[model samples]
Target: MHTTPLTADLVRGALDLERTEHGLLPHRLPARARAQCADPQLHLAESQPSGVRLVFRTRAGTVELDTLPTKRVYVGAPPRPDGVYDLLVDGRPAGSASVTGGNTLTIDMAAGTAEQRPGPVGTVRFTGLPATVKDVEIWLPHNETTELVALRTDAPVEPVPDRGRRVWLHHGSSISHGSDAASPTTTWPALAASLGGVELINLGLGGSALLDPFTARTLRDTPADLISVKLGINLVNTDLMRLRAFGPAVHGFLDTVREGRPDTPLLVVSPILCPIHEDTPGPCAPDFGALSSGRLRFRATGDPAERAHGKLTLGVIRDELARIARQRAAEDPHLYYLDGRDLYGEADSAELPLPDDLHPDAATHRRIGERFAALAFAPGGPFADRAV
Candidate 1:
């Protein structure tokens, strides 16, 4: 069958796009911002296109997407599975697919080095669709860096018109990036976006939410009616800063965002419950025993006594965030705080244990999404549409 090509202009939900030699690369961070940071983890996470998708109206019986996906593998660890591409017809999941044979990124945590091995591109095809015209969305891989080479459809495709939903801009670490979620749409942020009836621009870069200045600037420049930043976990896991540095960093991050959105409803959320890092400080390390058995889990390796010397634990971060929010709120009423525990606390953890001792599982994502919707997006909530 003859195919019509669709371009990046037909895509939505991505914060930025770059035209690469292969095709269009969707990025959570724009080129200007990305150029300022040389962090490999940030580079990898932003390019994965967590909330990005191609949305168009079509009646095509078959659709094809050609992509070059870069998959990651840790040395001596269990092989990772191929990232999933989720298809939605008129807003409901219709099918799923995965591409094979792309680039491979090999990481040696002990050596602190990574290398990329190039490979051929792969295609994902979805056939047997109905003839009736419908809105179709192809959600890109939430965990793999995908270079969208081509989008082909049996029928001509056009961009889905804006539905006048409020734009929600959110930034955080892996949990917000859909870590361990079963599918792209089922990610907690995605679920919350759906429930809040908003258009989401997710900047949830795994292992890279270090309160970077460029990230704050990106948020400042972006147009968003509602904004949130989930902070702390990444800092603890990386042991990036002491308590004194964290307070200023959080303030600075919020300051930059307020530059662009002076009155926007900006929310500051602390880290969710991660038992390992609650009282113990980090540099969290993977549990080798778990990994050897083909399971992945993290254990805090920093000394608890180091908390006296200004090291940060999840508990420390939460208290600091609350203090920062309260002090700032006196001057900036629009700024707000939601204890991350409210979304996923000790009680919730008891019911839905985090399988990796870090990231929440698929079921917990739903629970957090639902609770977030009620607390932040419901009537009288911080993000509620006042016009309604």
Candidate 2:
């Protein structure tokens, strides 16, 4: 087969790109923003490219992609499943694939050290596509850091022209990063983007959605028709800040974003229901008993009484977010608030419990995606007609 190489110019949705010795590494955060953060967790999450994808027009019957996926391994924890790559043809699901033989980043949480082991690249090939020319989208793995080594197709490919849809830029933690979701496209944010008919630039960095100034600056600089920032959960889980700092941090984050997009419709979403952290603070620790049984679960390690001393909890964060949104809305009509509980509340939790006691399962991702579309993007909703 005469193969044609697909380069970075043919890819869409990645915020930034870095050329590595092996190939092109797509980054969800721009270089300026990434340069400001030295946190290892943020470094890993932002480079994973959760919503970034390669979209093009092709008539090729066969497509092949070679990637160097950096898979994470926790020394004492159960191994994670391979991240999935989803292929969409003409806006419909066509097939899926997973890569193997990539580098490994092994972390010993107890020892607090991480080691990298280099490995060979792997290829994912799809054959037997329809002969007619059509749009093709290969969604990168949401959970793994993938370095695109090469792309080859039997026929030449061209970057898909902009569809003129509104760009929805969203930032949040792992739940928004597709944690435990079945595939890249099925993540709540992805599903919501599809249903809402918008282009998604997801900045849902897993375990890394602290309201950092750099992140807010990135948002301020990015162009988007609609935007949202889901806050609180990661902060609580890491116990990164106290109540005193959180309010100002949230304000500063929003203030920075507004500086660039003063009139854009911006929605602030609070964290969804997490029973373990509802009243109690966190430092969420793993449930070893569950882990021993090959199940992953988490329990809040902080005492509820600590809230009196300004330790933050999910409930407290929710109140502050609502208060901030309301106070700011008085001057900014484009700014709106959507309680996270509206998407997934205590009532929904009883029926569809979070398997990990932190992130929602696949079913819940669909539910939340559907509810978000209805509440935020439906007619008269904050984002309604904005994408159109």
Model 1 quality (TM-score): 0.96
- Tell me each candidate's TM-score: 0.96, 0.97
The local distance difference test score of each candidate is 0.91, 0.91
Instruction: List candidate 2 segments past 4 Å from native.
Output: 2-6, 386-388
Candidate 2 accuracy as TM-score? 0.97
Question: What does candidate 1's lDDT look like per residue over 5-108, in tens digits?
Answer: 55666878787778888888888998899899898889999999899998888889899999999999987677888999999998888999999999999997
Error of 2 at 110 (Å): 2.5
Writing each residue's lDDT as its tens digit, candidate 2 over 92-128 gives 9999999988999998665679999999999988889
Clashes of each: 0, 0
Residue 257's lDDT in candidate 2: 98
